[model samples]
Target: MASTEETKTAQVRIQLTTRYPDIELPDDPGPLLVSTGFRRYALSTLVNNLLQTERPVPFEFLINGQFLRTSIDEFLTANGISAETTLTVEYVRALIPPLHVSSYEHDDWISSVDVLSGSSPAVREAEEVSSGQERILSGGYDGLFRMWNMSNEVIATSNAPDEGGHTLAIKSVKFISPQKIASSSMDRTIRVWDYSEESATLTPTLELYGHKSSVDSIAVHSQSSRILSSSSDRSVGLWTTKKSEAPSAPENLIPKARNKRRKLSHPTPSKTGTQRGPLSLLTGHTDVVSSAIFSPTDHTVGYSASWDHTIRTWDLTTSACVDTRTTAHPLLSLAAMNGANLLAAGTSARHITMIDPRASATTIAAMTLRGHTNGVVSLAADPDSPYGLVSGSHDGTCRVWDIRSVRPGVGEVGGGQVGESVYVIPREILKEKGKSKAPVGGEGLKVFGVCWDKHVGIVSVGEDKRVQVNKAGDIIRT
Candidate 1:
């Protein structure tokens, strides 16, 4: 029976062909006829050898009885077969499997947000208090001085008493104490206000009058009761608080500039009475002094940027000029950072210059920023990120710049390589669609101020009569 079965099986022979014309089968039938117990095993071996025969496998297939299917071409491709290359398998199992693929989708909006209010009517100046809360004192064209309670929702607005006066438009306001506020106005006087404990309301305490011109700016000493005010009269005046007393005669009001040759000349009364005197007269600039700020780190030192196209550092104790730099154009605003060592000034020329007060008073013109098409009106620095700065421009936009990589050059105070920008907030340009139903002459937005609150993020005020609060580039509230 065994002899009859072996004769009936009669050595099954097979020949394989591939799409690669160079691959060939061996001429010797001895190796081909070696009886591997499984017919599929012998077929798989032949297919793998054909794939490795120095020719690429255009396609792969498996054959068993009358069925044919594709195989996974691992031996040929090693990594995996791709769409461009076809793979085939040859096998004796009577069936083949189908090829399969898989399919996938991304998101748009920002993930999280934190919102806080900006100073209303556009904050003219903002200062961070030691308590981690911000003291943002703002002046409005409406002749009001408002103090925003950043810790609460409702902002406290207060007006100085009329005091036989009319329509006092506040031009500048500064915080002297938690209980006291000082403001300068078109009224040509500096009024100090005392706040009620719980009500957060302000009442006029005293009206100081020495500036011959309208007081344009005010700065207070962090440690002392003294106050400094700059005026359009081209002068900076220092004031000290005093208690009221009974009225007295106005005598000795003129000065006696006498000659030695003249005998026994009567002295003229001094024009400036004992009521006030400027500690020192800073007279370098020929134009109106616009802004003056005391260094937050050093009480004895301060800086002033003026419409005279110059910035000067002054020693408050001696009232002497320490350093000065002349701008190509009139400066509109000024900011000092890193303990007043690095100074930034914005000009009417639409350029921003960085300076080092301790170094030579030369402006680092190469470090100028030219993004704003209109004049830069204000600038603020991040409390946590010293290199991060936010600027508001008349072009109706606010931009954030990261200047962490900027470094000063050798022997140059503020002369350093320009930094790369990490973020920028573009101006929201409004498009006028058509003539129908549109207001006669209404233009779009105009940004008046931009400020960064440690607790609040970035806040911007515009001429559109809106205050926009943004956190991480997205407008959280308007």
Candidate 2:
């Protein structure tokens, strides 16, 4: 009689197809005889070896859309799979959850386009034009704002008239409509330009000048023509777009497009200014307010991050500050996540503090994320991507953090007392192309703005004067 192991083994015919396109493998290779063994690892190895051509590649197996992870015999037995059953399995590279980044998978990411450099230093911010994905707007420290086509080339070249653009370093840029854009600058003024509609050279239809200091950031309400702008003046101002007389500064607003100059007709003013002064100035933070955003869930409710080491939520209906709480570190940036019901705030300590706004009014972070070696100054929450949040730090790296993997545990570091009750989540790092990933670090070009979309991947700009767009994700092996 055969030994117990041999007696229990099943003779299964295994048909294989690689799910990873980047890690090349054979196409339609003949089936192999796989004996379902007591050891799951051995069966996994047999399939992996046959799927790989040059070297064995790591993979996860699924049979008939059902995932399999343990010993083959046990799994089959548990699933009521018979000994004579033929197993058709699909082999795929190991995967990190969508929107999440892993240290193990930078090789799969490719810089789809060569770095698109700007005319200035430190590309401060970037946003995809929602009306048309073909156009992307990039703001810079060189006091220039340029629009690029889908190909990453500057728009309005050789053919169409360019819009009225900023003259000073643009601190914030937001698209109000496909043809309309609002940009705030260090020049202490905001311009609302008719960016795409008219045929003639584009110029500001309205210029907003109310904030006493350079505006650091701006957010537009999803439901109305309202805007919230945070300034170095240590206050957040709320403004609305009211019908005004013709613009008095139309001539001053229009700048000669790069390499192409077109004179614009002085726009006859129906309004004297681009916008009326603040509907209400949210004043409380003792230091510069770095970022303010309308809550994605409720437009009337919004949050602001300040250098005062505090985050404040205000009621826009009354202009009243409703909640205030101090954080663990000086706040530099903020990204409000609706899906997770969490406020992701970047801090001076090279860490990210996620707060449950639904929690009591106390200003405590529910959990903290650490990896960067310098202050984290920018954060972008991928609404479509539930697995992660992207951060840009002073260390010149844009890191994607997988929040889905964080769990509560007990541990102590940095002089903070840890009790058995405290929950601790371990650390993860962002992987970079060409460079080996640091055990714990971010990846970027001395970033100022970081944004990611399912289709666009991660787009970052910084002191390097170049816009970097990385198509990050794993490819299937053929």
TM per candidate? 0.56, 0.62
lDDT of each: 0.51, 0.60
**Candidate 1's TM-score:** 0.56
The runs of at least 3 residues in candidate 2 whose Cα sits more than 4 Å from the true structure, single-residue gaps closed, are: 1-133, 156-167, 197-201, 244-275, 359-363, 407-444, 473-478
Cα lDDT for residue 194, model 2? Answer: 60
lDDT of 2 at 53: 50
Residues 258-286 of candidate 2: C-alpha lDDT, one tens digit per residue? 33355544433323234334577888889
Candidate 2: worst-modelled 10 consecutive residues by lDDT: 417-426
Candidate 2 structure, TM-score to reference: 0.62
Task: Estimate candidate 1's alpha-carbon lDDT, on a 0 to 1 scale.
Answer: 0.51
Best by lDDT: 2
Local accuracy of candidate 1 as per-residue lDDT tens digits, 147-176: 554543335565533332214556666666
